[model samples]
Target: MRKIIIGVMGPGERAREDHVRNAFELGRLIAQEGWVTLTGGRNAGVMEAASLGAKEAGGLTLGILPTRDRNLISVAVDIPIITDMGSARNNINALTSDLIIACGLGTGTASEVALALKANTPVILLTENEEGKRFFKALKPKLVFIAKEPSEAIQMAKEILSP
Candidate 1:
């Protein structure tokens, strides 16, 4: 059976405290459920936090890097796929994951969510950004869901991915 991959998307450098906390918990919970946690692979913000939690919880983590700089890769990343494609790597992140949980609102995260929606992939927006929620939901009513919390995001992932 293929392991489910849940991509954690959020701001890299300017991550909010809530976003970091939520991403960590989400990664931990995702690990507990025996799922793979995927992130941007950077050593900052949600990518680092989520990978750290997942790695600590004994989960497999895959990081899709937007840069060729190996030093930027998260220490917790078990597998890092270096992509020199820059922000365009968001396409890979959005398309590769079985599900995506947007941990916060950011330009990068928004693009990932949009790419996911465009591909008809399921996304759970785990942010309090009402405007973002409204915009995304307006784009894909069924494919886009909102979760106010990390645990709820996990539950929504299950509901979205289950056969």
Candidate 2:
């Protein structure tokens, strides 16, 4: 089976309690579905929450780190792909995925969403906020999908990947 690489994009800063819990649930759902997870290797917020969930579930968690230094990779990451591409690393990360899941995030996540859009990869935005809705609305039929919650996002991703 071709590994279903699910790109989990989100903010690196400290997240709210709800976002953290959701991230964990999202990661567990991805792992439970037997899909591979890809994310930026960082130690806080959504990245840490998701990676830890996936790892605990015995899922393959691939982390794409911006720095070439191995020590920069997050401890929760199972496989670290270190690159010196800086912000451009988002492009590589999106390219490695079959689907992209955008959690509540800031600038970095926005960049990943844009990269996924450019790549024509299916993106499932798990958000209910006006900003997220408006963002997708502006895209106007580019294959960007919206889901109100993690479960819906997971289901949408599965549907997109189904043969």
Clashing pairs in model 2? none
- Candidate 1 structure quality by residue, lDDT tens digits, 3-95: 999999999889999999999998999999999999999999999999999988999999999989999999999999998999999999999
| Per-candidate clash tally | 0, 0
lDDT of 2 by residue, 39-125 (tens): 898777788788988888888898888878776677989888888788889999789989888887577887888788888888888
> Candidate 1 — which pairs collide?
none
Compare the candidates by TM-score and give the number of the best one.
Answer: 1
Clash count (model 2, backbone only): 0
Reference-based lDDT, each prediction: 0.93, 0.81
**What are the models' TM-scores?**
0.98, 0.92
